[model samples]
Each structure stands twice: as C-alpha cells, then as structure tokens.
Target chain A: MNLAFTEIQETIRMVQMESLDIRTVTMGISLRDCIDSDFDSMNNKVYEKITSYAGQLRPVAEQVEKEYGIPIINKRISITPVAELLGHASKDQAVQLAKTLDKAARDLGVDFIGGYSALVHKGITKGDQTLLEALPEALSVTERVCASVSVATTRTGINMDAVKQMGEIIKEASELTKDANGIACAKLVVFCNPVEDNPFMAGAFHGTGEGEAVINVGVSGPGVVLNALKRHSDADLGEISEVIKRTVFKITRAGEMIGRVVAERLSLPFGIMDLSLAPTNAMNDSVAEILEEIGLERVGTHGTIAALALMNDAVKKGGAMASSYVGGLSGAFIPVSEDNGMIKGIEDGALSLSKLEAMTCVCSVGLDMIALTGDASASSLSGLIADEMAIGMINKKTTAVRVIPVPGKSEGEMVEFGGLLGRAPVMGVNPFSSEKLINRGGRIPAPLQALIN
Target chain B: MEQKRAVVSVVGKDQIGIIAKVTTCLSENKMNVLDISQTILQDFFTMMMIVDVSEAEDLAKLHDDLDKVSQELGLKIDIQLEDIFQTMHRI
Candidate 1:
C-alpha cells in the first residue's frame, strides 16, 4: 500500500474518536467599497456585497466536507470593520447596518457574521463613537451578528476612554438580553492588538489591507493533541513538546489543504490558516485536559502557566512548518465555558479569575467567556480590561476580554448560554474598587517596546 | 490518465459475505479496487481498500450505497478521498 495501514488508521482515529476537525472556514469579504452617503444606500450595498460573495459559502463547505470526510464545524463570514463604513451614518444607522449584516448571514445560512467592529485603540472618531453607542442595541436585536472593539495596541497604548465606555457597553448589552442569561455578551469582545485576518468569530474582521475577498480557515484539534500526549505519558517534558509539535504539524497541514481547496472551489484567494487549538464543551476535546496530561492536577495550579507556555510555543513552531502562511491568534484557547476541563477546574476551586488572567499572558486570547456577578461594578469590568490590555501591550501579543455579567445572577451561580457559547459559573471579582483608576479617562502611553524601529 | 483514488474502510465483527457485498457494489459503480488489506485486531475485523474512483459517476451516491451495505452487514464503513491521508501523514 502506498500509505501504511497505521497511517490510514491514525487519520481516521483523529476524526472519528479524537474530534479532530476544522473549527471554521471564514470568508473575509472586504466592504470598504460598500460605503455610501445615504444610509439606506449604504445598507443595501453592504447586504448585496456580503450575500453575493458568501451566498455559496455554506453549500461549498458542505460539498468539501463530504468529499474529504473531515467535518467542518462552521462556515462564517467576516467583513471590513463597520466603523469605517459609518462615516456618513449615525448611531441608528450603525444598528441598521448590523441588521443588514444579520439578514445576509441568515439568508446565506452561515453560522455567524463578524466585523460589526470598531478600531478605536488610539482615539474614537465620530464613526467609531456611533458604532460603540449602537453596540448594545445592535447586538441585542441581531441573532447572528458578532462585534469587537480594539482599545489598545503596543504602538498606540491603551485608550482608557474607550475602555471605560466598553465596560458600560458590555453591561448594557448584557442587561438588554437579560432574559437569555446575558447571551448578547457572548457575541461581543473587546480586544487589544486585534488581528485583522482571524477566522474565529466574535473577533474576526477583514482588514483594510486584505483584498476584495479571501478565505481563512481555523483548525481545531485539542482532542487529537491530548490523545497523542496520552500515548507518550511517560515521556519527559522535551519529548512532550516534540509530540505536541508533531501533532500540530499534521493537523495544520490538513487545515491548509482544506483551506486551499475551498478557496479554489470558490475562485477566491487562499488566506492564512489559523492554527488555534480551540476547545469545545465536548468530552476529551479540551486544552485544559492537554495541560493536565502534561502533569498538572488541574488547569489553574502553579505550573499551569509553564505547561501552557510550552504548548503554545510548540504549536506555533509546528504550525509554521506546516503552513506557508499562518496568522490570527494561534495558540491554546482557555475559554472557561467552552472547554469541559476548564468548567471543572472552576467548579473544583482550582481556577480563579486572577489565575485565568495570569494564564492569558501565555495563552492565545484573554479572559474569554468568563461569567461575573450582576453586581460587578462597571469600574471593576474596566479594571479587568485594563489589566488584560496592559499584558497585551507589554508582551506585544493579541489579547481580548469577553466577560458576561449575568443579570440577577450572583457569584457561584451558573448561567447557561447554550450551544457553542456554553455555560459558565459566575466567578467573584475583587471587592476592591478600581473606580479611581478607571475614572482617569486618558490614554496610557505607548510601551517601551513600541520603539522597535 | 492518472486515477483519482479513495479509501474505503470497514470495521465490524467478522462475518460472511462482507467482502463480497462491498466488492459487488464497487464493480456496479465502475469503481475498481486497487489494493486491499484485512486484519482481526482485538476480535474485530478491520479492512482497508484503496479503490479507483476516477471513472465513477457520483461519489456521493457510492458513499450512500456503501452506507446501505454497512447497515445490512452491521459494520461501520467510510469512504474518503485519498488526498486527505496523503496531506496529513506525508509531508
């Protein structure tokens, strides 16, 4: 046989038993040209552009899945940040644009449509202000529209004003959807050093620099990595890193192949392959379990950071070797609600909010999908964002905050968001007030590393 | 002409008429089996077949046909493009 029997079985086992699959095949359609002076005209253009470019995204992805026999979990679309298209529009118009995007996603049968976003890391323009003001309404009314705001960058520093406003916006968004356990908050994220080519949602947006349209794919295989580690349980740390790298390399290669084929079928350009080990709420498909298999009793213990760092580093090393172009936030994702082990870690009292904050320093994204008490002050939320932004600014890595404060839910209670968003235990926040720091509304100066030129 | 190949795998308890049923369906669909290997691991029969699907009319229909055969034989059968295995296991 051209392929050994074991090789064939290995691929089958990865998909059938270990849950190896592509998380998303996101089509990035640039909408910079969809802007118009009239709000209705602009909305129509946006709708037409997205539907035309992505109308076949779902069917084509399904065809490829059948042919290749690799399950593709999501087919999504990300567009140019809506703030850029809102120059001639108002706050109401921003929400209207979100409605337009929602319709396009529904008509096309895509899972979610991202890029209802604003990039205000440096300062908020009139357009950015309108989008921020409309976020709560826009998110509350839409079923499939996801939004993100980038408030800090290493070169631009932290926008304290935007950070403060986002804290209020998060609270309002949660309150508006209070009946659904603050589900709206699950579709909104606040980012620092946000990537433009991310294929994963609530944060993916087609960058201004991208072409008219491109296809980016995100590969997820936490289960495959965990199973491989279990096979080499007796191996030392160096050997463990090697095992992770090899597994990542194989999965990344598969992702690249799928992405290129999908691009060819759509007659679009093949963009980067995001090699993120995004975990789901399924058993054996967890990043925390991989860390535990690496010798931690739980995910939030003292050695968790070191284990995560090694895994993140090895993923990049192997993924780089496998793909010619790999971008987005590529590392282990630690969303507390989405991964079974993380939920268990929180329930077992080993994972705390502060511990999660520290882990984000080494992982891919920041305090993702965490639930806070209803009484958590907006100032405390701003304080949490500020702290995570500082880590991203100083470390020059992409970080984000997507915390939900469930209305009428207190600490130690569970709020179910259901589906891929999963349920999270409401964790307590520090009682100490951050009002003093959050009240000072100005930008934090750029970090010393920003002068790399 | 270069042949487009796919892998057809079957796993179940060893039983009579399993191979005959699968090969009959492939010939009916104009798909030729290039090579095959079967083994009994942990008391379950496993078989891997590389088949030339280039001349086949419809891959989806063939998949459906094999699915029906699997149900009748009480086995799990899967057919996938060989490119997936080549891309993953081979550099």
Candidate 2:
C-alpha cells in the first residue's frame, strides 16, 4: 500500500510511543558580523541573536511532536565557527568568547552549540590559527560548546601537520577534563569533509555559501530499523533491501516534514534532508547489530567490512529514495560503547581498531567510541587520530574522531558515563608511534592521482 | 538425466519454524538446497532458497506441498523454475 506522504516525520515511520520525541530543533544562525573590539558586547550580541530566534525552537518542536505524534530529538543552534566570530580578536579574548557561548547555551537550554569549527582543507587562515591555539582554554572553560576541524581531504592527500597538532590538542583537552569520558573532547570532531547543513551536534555549522538562513535536518532511527529487521528474519538479500528502503523512506519523511515546518515557521530556506541512521547507546538499536544479523558473527571481524558496506549502501539507498534531497554522511555508525553489539564485539575479540577503520571507510564517522588509556601518550593518541584522518582523506567522505581518553583506566576495564554516554570497556591501542614522522608538521600536498577516478 | 532448479523467494512477517517448514518441504520433495540466505525486511521475514530438484519424485506435487506450507506459515511464496535461479545472482 502506498503510504500517503504528508508530514516529514510520518514519512520516516516515526511512531511517538513514549515521552521521547526528536530531542532538538536547531537554528543555524550566522555570527559573521558579531565581531567587536570589546569581547563583552560582541559575545552578548551573539547570545541575544541565538536566544531570541531559537527561543521559539523548543516550543515549536514540542508543538509539532504533539500534533503529529512524532518526537523531535534535540533543539540546538549552529553558528559560524567561533573562530570566524572572533576573527579580529586576541587569544585570551577567544577563550572569553568560548565562555560566553557556554553560558548562553546553558541559559538558553540548548544542549550544545556547534560551529566552533575551522575549515583548513588547504591551509589554515589567521582566524583559524588563532582558534586552533585557543582550543585548549576555550574547550576547557566551555560546557555546551562543540568544535570541529577539517584537516585533510581527497583532493588534499593529508594535512600531516594539522593532524599531528590536533592529536596533541585532543589529548590536552582530555587531560583537563578527565570525567564524563572527556566530555569536552567528546564535543570535538575532526572532519575530512564537513558539510554545511548537518543538524547534528558537535559538527553543525553555517557554511560560507549558505543563505541568510537555512534549515537542515538530521534524522536518526537505528532502533526502529533494527526492530523492523528483527521482524523480517527470513528475507533474502533483495527482499531485505526492499524492507530497509521502505523503513528509511518513513524515517526520511519524518525529517523532511520537521525541516519544512521549522523552515516555514521561522521564514528560513529549507535545506536538504539528511537521512543518517545515527545510533545512540540504546539497546537493540545499533548499526553493528544490523551487520551481525546479516551473517557477520561480530562487528570487527573479517567479514565485518562486507557486512558494513552492504548495510551502509542499503540504508543510503532506502533513505535517498525516501527524500528528494538526501545529503551528509548518511551511513551506519560503529562506536564501540554506543552500540552494545560493537562493545560486545570489541570485548569478544570480534572487533578491533583496524577493522573499525575498514568499516568506517563505508560507514558514518570514524574512530568513534575509541577509549584510550589515560596513560596513552599524547603522540600515541595522535597516531590513532592520524590513522582515522587518513581514511577520510583517502575516501573523500566526512569522518570524525570522538576519542575518549578515560583517565586512570587500563585496557579491558569498563568506563561508565551513565545514560547516553553509555558504558564502555576500554580497548587496547598500539603503544608505539611515529613521533618522528608526525612531528614533521607541514602540509602534505594533495596527490595528483586523487584527481582521477 | 534431467536437471531441475527452483528460485524460492520467501516474504512475510517473521515467525518461528520458517526455515524448518520450508526446508522440510524442499527435502521431502527430493529437492537439494543449492544455496540459501535469509534476512529480515523491516518487520517481515524474507529468504531466497535456490533448490536443485532434478532428483525430485514429483515436481507438480512438490510445488503444491510447498504452497500448502506457505499458506500454513503466513508467508508469501514465489517460485521460479530452474532457469532463472541459475542465471540470477549466482556467485
């Protein structure tokens, strides 16, 4: 039966059963002109603009959820990367700017304010350099701010220097905040290809090419898809793909409807509908489980690569067919602690860092839920990040590293951050590193062959 | 000797004993499962069974028996005779 496509949420098969709804309705506000000689006034302007426009976001999202029986996951805001906002400012002033963002996000009730990002695929600008320097202090002081840096790309083989530097910076960020699995570092994303309209947290930012205002959506439903798959236990490959396509169509519809509403309500341009099956720490709702169901014994096994590629391709196909404009890194997620299956796989010797990297070549995000020992040296952690960065730079896909260096923990130990943060059993990492190799911090120019097919 | 193959596509809500019932039907009819794979499609259970039935006692009766099994198990069954199953997606 052709399900009548009405609301975007309904299109995505969103059955709002519990009190849970789509958590947030993020407003992407541009902070290009918020620069000032005095930091206080400028920060205040930035806060006022976000608070005033986005104050209505929660109420509207709730109203939509209530009216349509769909749950909106988050109500958030993305600004021009904080560095651009503080372009004309100094180092200390940048930290103060980050502080201002923290207070405003806390007061406004937005879970996280993204756009503390820098695009340095080719080279770092002056503002980007300043932002990079202030990261340790800015991240340390801020509670609700998120940051991202794109250091490499397919066109640009790898920014060995930036990748090496960020490895140190991330470890430093973790050192200051030991608890919550380095919650501050959790907010940082290292991108090879960062998109403009990703409505997800920690990476969402207003791109330079965007209009005055535009609405992008992040639709997630790993739980729903997994549940559906469970009920279709005997479907063949073709039949299974059909089922997935149908399910994703419903999920994509949900996003499209929500995005259309938010755009219309705020009088902003509606951007593309991003159909990523973003997984969380929920039980029975994991991308890894999907692989397991498809005959892979474990998530990080030899067969795991093919399994992930199949699922990722299938999900994108289904979601893309559902929505007119499907964008962003739409694929499966394989965070160790986030997906119970992945965690179990990691614990059971079914998954490994190398396998996870292979999977990330096809799936969404990279080196995520990778919890290193607090004793993991700065250069060692950098080596790990470099490996992941290498994947994205080669594949030409958007990849992010959310490495949590759990303090005072050894390998095989469990680290619990409670709800959503989930429980993670620490995995082992290579102690040895290429400090000599990584320390040679210069732009690794793009490979000429990368331009070819 | 004559060679017979069937493309068996199973689709419906997942229930217990699907594989047992379907495989039993094939086995009783002297059909050897050439290859079989299953996965869930949303809330539905789907499977494709490639069976070589050259040695079957009765082709028509086997089809009828499998149809009965399909009805009893609440599954949608499509049977494609040997030629197509051999040609499509053979690895």
Which candidate leads in TM-score? 1
Residue A184, candidate 1: Cα error in Å is 0.5
Interface RMSD of each: 0.6, 19.2
Which residue segments of model 1 deviate by more than 4 Å? none
* Candidate 2 chain B worst ten-residue window by lDDT: B82-91
DockQ of each: 0.87, 0.01
Model 1, position A305: C-alpha lDDT score: 96
Q: Quote each prediction's TM-score.
A: 0.99, 0.78
Tens digit per residue, CA lDDT, model 2, B1-91: 7656655667788988998999888888778887777777588776776678779766557657878998998887655553321211121
How far out, in Å, is residue A11 in model 2? 9.0
The TM-scores of chain A alone, one per candidate, are 0.99, 0.92
Q: State the lDDT of candidate 1 residue by residue for A1-453, as single tens digits.
A: 389999999998899899999999999999988888888988899999999899889999998998888999999999999999999687888888899899999999999999999999999998999999999999999999999999999999999999999999999999999999888999999999999999998899999889999999999999999999999989999999999999999999999999999999999999999999999988899999999999999989989999999999999999999998999988888998998899999999999999999999999988899999988889999999999999999999999999999999988898888999888999988999999999999999999999999
- Full-model lDDT for every candidate: 0.94, 0.72
DockQ, Cα level, model 2 = 0.01
Candidate 2 lDDT, A17-128, residue by residue in tens: 2122343456788877777767788988987877776776666666555434356767777888776766677888788878877887888777778888888877887888
Clashing pairs in 1: none
